[model samples]
Target chain A: MTEQPILEVKHLQHIYMKGTPLEHHALAGVSLKINKGECIAVIGHTGSGKSTLIQHVNGLMRPQAGDVVVDGMDLADPKIDIRLLRRKVGLVFQNPEDQIFEKIIGDDIAYGPFKMGLPIKEVRDRVKWAMELVGLSFEEMKDRATYALSGGQKRKVALAGVLALRPDILVLDEPTAGLDPRSRNELLERLKTLNKKENMTIIFVSHNMEEVAYMADRIYVLADGRNLVDGTPEEVFVEAEKLREHYIGTPDTVEILAQLKAKGFAVRQNAYQLEEAANEIIALL
Target chain B: MALPLIQVKNLSFEYAVNQTKIPVLHDISFEVKPGEYVVIIGHNGSGKSTLSKHLNGILTPVSGDVVVNGWNTKEWSSMREIRQKVGMVFQHPDNQIVATIVEDDVAFGLENLEIPPSEMKERIDFALASVGMNEFRNRPPHYLSGGQKQRVAIAGVLAMKPDCLVLDEATSMLDTHGRNEILKVVRKLNDEGMAIISVTHHMSEAAQASRVIVIEKGRIIMDGTPREIFQQEEELKRLHLDIPVASQMARKVQSHHHDFNGTLIHNDEIVKEVVRLSQREVPVI
Candidate 1:
């Protein structure tokens, strides 16, 4: 038997300020299915409904039409517990400052598990685990003032808070948007470890094609609140013309190969990794 | 030769926590000439944002000087003049936007200087036109896309008629399309003889800059052209930073075939070089 999807959305539709002059169709007939341990990326330009789609994953936004199911719980069911669903899917917003509240880092990260009524010892243990997972030392940084930390540290604290809940799935919206190259790479590596070692499903919304190419095993392209295409990074990026039509760009690796092909060089355009793209060009030479 | 537009000398900054002062920026010095496009890149908490704040008097140095157009930021009476000479745009567009309407938002800065209504109108028009947001002037900022909102923010700063623009991760919160929009405007402004100092972590953005400055642990560690800086790929990786993908790919190809000599940072340059190399009678390794 085929493995069941951990999260599934079918023909999802949403309209902002419905029936008013300022109403906007934010999502229209979008559909996607994600496996339990998969790392997926939803990429689109501004106003492309990527944010709206993720909001539905954790019950932040109910389906205006169509259906959403997370871990066998149907969102359309009136008796379904949103609180429980949120615990299963941790969603991190774009800005770390938006979610952080406690002055101390440890207390902030412990908030989620504490609210769940877990034992005090378990809460502390979970906070320690989450902090270490995000590369923050529990001993050194747990007492640090949240406001005094750098942008990267603040983001780590926010992520640790979400991870402390021990969610089955982690969703991040532009997780590396404002981070430096080092921090961005470190965060991506942590997420990969979560997916590989813990079997945690990862879903992220991003505008950075390079990040998407590096982290996503499966890719979904969105445009105008609709699912434009879905496939592996190489498959989606090879359709460069289609992505450009929607104001999306391919990763630099694929872009350079495509440019060489346009210049009459016999180079492969499907390479998404730097080493692979380099090999393709070297072969041509 | 044109006089320097801004100069920083022996700058040091510290943030006061409960009872202790924590230093965030070391003794730093740099000079930006007129019409120069300089990009400051570093890992998060490397004092890049802290340094950018000093340019416009947002943060006063503890033991150093920042002179803008011959006016010292340390002088209280010259603050207004210094601010008018150096306008800053921050990361988030929503936080920076004040007025409900786009045109009014652009005019807000002009009115602060108590400019006459006639001159205010002219300045607002010129500012909006410069960012290509004149058509959205009457619309609500909330209704605009992220890129459009950022353009509006830049217009607001432009209305002040600043000689230098300091962008502190201004494009960090924007999508790829939005980033491109902002870069296009910045490049055009620099072409028109306006000095720009952009602080960001995006190596691809740094590739477009005339000069690249790398900061680490609150100190300026490297300063040179993009080509000069990105060529030291090992050093950048050691600092937890990354060169642009195009540059990385070029180096990888160079490793396989020892003939590629030049340091190519941009996509087009790499693509052209690859095509030229493919035309040569070099054997693949």
Candidate 2:
């Protein structure tokens, strides 16, 4: 909607283990700009530098070449405060267990504000608010052991921990990876609220085609450490051959449409939903 | 003509958690014949992963019989042999891996058996190639994506020369592209007569398999070919599992059209079916 983007990654190149037998050029000259309040999904086959690229956004890793400019702050600048950056752009990793350190749910949620040197009252309020954000009840789960929570609940606690930090941009690496269906939907709904109500910029890394179709406003496909395609979900997924070549699978709806088209059927190639595709075909005949 | 690849009879497991023997699984029974690609579906806490673990002696049953290659699970001597017969790839490849180098990780399981070093390299090469990880044989695990790491995990097991491969939510953490890559590898392995038992929540993934088994609280609640299992649209939804988006569309269209006749699964199939239905003249009142 604007000329300047909320976040700009300019010619970002990342090389792990710079000069040794184990050296890896994980990313090579990747450049893209993400606007504020954007919900972008990053999809790629394993070892495609998706994780590497996202880590750079939060200053977790420094790019060997190029830089990530978030809110006009240069990621590669040595003088930049990584702690402040981490607070603004929260990154939740693949496993919930990795960051869940507190004994109880409430303490875990408050860990962020506590670390940020907030007053005790402020931390307490944030813990309650963050738990509510992820749909964890204060009366039921506040004192429960973090270890006792289900996989889905643990993921929520992790999310609550991030939310307490008041991040403007949330970068999640497989946030819904291990969740149940209800929990996944609930998390997505909460995330939609965060993106809309709180106006948090969301860059979610996922491989679930349906989730991507349902959630992402824009998508970036990666392969062999390169940005393969960048477009809206409808456009990026419509090119079946390109997706296949890049190891990205089309959404189930689109895949079905393509299969029908291949079998001497009259399904519109653009339909990315069963109902829409069915409607398109019905209208066609 | 030959022994079934794997069989489970009233298998149950309980572990002592805080002095209470919490039953993670109840009485569950299933069987996998050779060349069968079976997918077990369930929500979180439905015992899908626990069931997959029991298939390969990763977790021995406490109450029932698990027989692999005619070897009873209770027979202590069969533990190693059973594991050798049924290879496993876990949900998180990072935890499953035991080595740094890709080829070495592939060769890890074989090396565990004290296989002759001379032949180990060949098996490693073949296994790496099987999962398309051959080119990255010398790469470290940290440099790869979640899918590639999982593939290497699969190759490690492949090098062990197992006949049945049980993936316990293996693709749960993978993004769409990574999931597809793993699916292709699973299909390839199954086609080559490797009995595959994948425990997943993704119904779309189950659509690729020949048979789907839905487990609930440690019981085989639903079991049939993909077509048969998915046709039970209502039951799957009750279990909190999603029907393929195409099926949902079909159900929608079928409700309004009194004389619609089409058995469609993929969205494209819905498109084809709708096209056919639309072209039909209106029925006589």
Candidate 3:
């Protein structure tokens, strides 16, 4: 939507354990551009390089070949500070346990700000702000034992920890992977607020078609480390046949629409949400 | 002609902290038949995972008992026998995979059971093939995809020839494709007479099960076929659970077309109903 993209990846390629029997081409010529304040989703089957691509965005892994520029800063530049780059691009792993090590919720959230060498008062303020932003009440959860919290609560703590750094670009790998329906909904809502009110650039990696359909303004499909498709949710999801070939699935609404068309119903097979599909079916009826 | 593979009777479990008891599972009772595909659906803290642990003797119930293949879980002497009859696969595949090589990991459980080398070879071959991981048998567990690793984990469980498999959100951490891969294996195993008790939050996956059990606040709140369970979408939503997409779509269509009678648990049924409605001669107001 803008001349300068917030995130730009060009001809990215990565190989794991290169030049060995276990060599794996994790990413192959993957390219994408994310505009500022956009909610972008990277979807792929397992081993399709979704994780590999996101790691490059935050400098967690340097690009083997190709270029990745985040907010106008080329990640390949030798002079760029890795710490500053990571702070600007928040990366949340699939498992919250992997990132959250502090016993107390407040302590875990404050770890990022504290490490950034912020003043103690500012660190505390950011900790409370981050917790509240993720829907965790600071007063109630500050002293709560991290281990005692539910899976969703723990995930929120992990998100809060990253948010405490006030990263401009928030990237999450399967943020709702293990969450129940309610928690998933609550977290998505919170993210939507952040994307809208704060104009945060969100780039999430997920394989959940329904969640992608609901949340993503744009989607990039990866298969075996290669970029397969990229478009709006409706545009990408309508290619149910194409997605299936790569072991990727579209949202249930799109699948149902396809099924209806296959069943000789004169209905548009393009709906990505339940209400839209229902409207299309009702119109046809 | 055969008894249920798992019979949980008046099971109650609680965790103690600082002399205060916190109830986890409250008066839970259920039975899983041989070859039955049973999906346990619940929100976080609903005690679904705790109940799964009770089935395999990982945790003894505070009161009552779990009888697996007529062996009571409460009896300390029957722990090994119960564990043998009921194998468990956890959410994280990384945690479950032990050996470096795929075949070695599959053979880990067999070796623990003191199985002979000749028999172990046959069992491992059968197990790996059943889960469609034979191609990656020689590959390293660390190099395999998440889906492949989980299948290897399943193959490990299968090598022991457990009568039932308890997947404690095993597919929750996987992408959509990985989830389907594991579910396909589980369905195939169930069809071949391995009773399955899968604790999951994926409504679509739950809809494929022969039976669905809804857990809430440490109790078994609803138990029925997928159709019966999904029909009560409102009730499920109240409990922080969701109905499958097809069912949700059917509800939306029904709002306009009152006579749109349809069995809406699966995609095919919804398609058929949409076709029927399109062909109907009645003209709505």
Candidate 4:
């Protein structure tokens, strides 16, 4: 990649319970190049190492025999200042309940900045900005109990916690996993703003192909702990059958086209969404 | 008289948060038939969750009857029987999990019932196999992915052998892979004759189920098959739900080409339908 990627995962291998018979090859020779401001979406079935792979980026999980290099700091290097790197390359987990620790929303948002030993004024400023960025009102939500917030609010607060650190690269594991339509759209919009305005590079791991198709510049497909495929969403989803054989459902548009074609109907396999498919149908008529 | 699996007659509930009993659900009434799959859709604060909790008597209704297999939930005397018959799987897997080991957690419900040792083993094995989690039987719960852990959680309830399963946004916490995995299990269970009532925000996912119920502001707006519910796309949009991506694309193209054939909600159908029509001697166009 040009000028060395912002985040380079080189020959990364991770084995759970290594040496024991119960060991799993969570990641097998995975190497990826993520440049600044690029958003990459990783899609796979459950137990396909999507989460395991992301965890390795922030020293959350160390590779068994390889390294995760972010901005020249080798995560495998014991002497590397992990705390500094963690602050810069922040990780937001899928479940908000486990990640958010403090009682109040403001306190939880400021946890990361406070840990970095920032001045009180700066930490407070970072927390407020982070809260507003996620679209949580500062005055109303800040003083409220964290437990009082709805499921969507908890997620926004959890994200604010990570954003307060001002991480250059953000790694979110299924960030919109269970949000309703409005909340999901809001989160995606805010993320887009961050990527566009702040030049933040993002590695977003999601299972929703539509979201992946809409958001990512690149897509990675994982299966059986192997990097099965890698390309843009457009390129990756074109292989509808292969996607199905791997147990990853092709977006409805792709599947419908494949089915129609198999049943002696003429349709393009690459067409994924319903609207396009409809237009194509109408045109044929 | 043949009793329904679960019946909520004019159910209303309020949560006293901050000493304020906020009315969450009002005048909710429905019945889940034995061996039926019913999908519930609504935006947040639409009382979907509040209603789900009342299914298994997790939350007692304040103003009406929640009858489970002919037992009134307000009378706590029969709660043990009600819980045994109406098992639930919550949205987040981590919160509901009680044991560290996968198999042990799966056996938790059985242990509470004091199932005989031999019977427990038999049930546990069958449950694990049913959800396709037999291999991870010995692994710890913490190590499993959100979807896998959810399967284990399902196994936990399957071992109990409930008459109906209520998944309250269970798939929301999962990635596409996880969502599909759980959906497969849920569908299979429904086919095998267990009553399933799933509260979800995914229209595509709702399309897979036998029946769908749409609610807004704690009132039932529509109840029908996916075809019927989705055909009223304009209404769904009003409730902040989205049409499948393919359908939207089809609609978009239709605005340009009125000659396109068929009801296009997904892409492939539109393409095949189009090409087929265009190829005819007296072309459809």
Candidate DockQ values, in order, are 0.83, 0.45, 0.74, 0.49
Q: For model 3, how big is the iRMS in angstroms?
A: 1.3
- The stretch of ten residues in a row with the least summed lDDT in candidate 4 chain A is A276-285
lDDT of 1 by residue, B85-126 (tens): 899999888999999999999999888889999999999999
Error of 4 at B34 (Å): 3.5
Off by over 4 Å in 1: B282-285
lDDT of 4 at A193: 88
For model 1, the TM-score of its B chain against the native B chain is 0.96
Q: Give the CAPRI class of candidate 2.
A: acceptable
**Inter-residue clash pairs, candidate 1:** none
Candidate 4, A1-285: lDDT as tens digits: 357788888778888888999887888888788888899998888777888999888887877877688888888878888887897788999776578878988999988888888999999899899998888889888988888666777888999999999998999988886677767777888898898889999999887776776678888888877888888766888787777778787776666667766766667767655566554445445
Higher-lDDT candidate of 1 and 3: 1
Clash number for every model? 0, 4, 1, 17
Model 3 C-alpha lDDT per residue in residues A27-62, reported as the tens digit of each score: 988999998899999998877898889989988888
Better of 2 and 3 by DockQ: 3
Alpha carbon lDDT at B211, candidate 2:
91
Per-model TM-score, in order, reads 0.97, 0.86, 0.95, 0.86
Between the candidate structures 1 and 2, which one is better when assessed by TM-score? Answer: 1
Write candidate 2's Cα lDDT for B1-285 as tens digits.
Answer: 756788788888987767877688888877789989999888877878777877877788899989998999778888899889888888889898988888778877887799998899889888989999888999999878778899999998999889989898898877776777799999999989898888887777788788999887767888898878878877877887777666676666666664454445655466566557655756768
How many angstroms is residue B227 displaced in model 1 relative to the true structure, after the best TM-score fit? 0.9
* Candidate 2 deviant stretches above 4 angstroms: A1-5, A18-27, A45-48, A62-67, A148-150, A222-229, A239-241, A260-268, B1-5, B99-104, B111-146, B256-263, B266-285
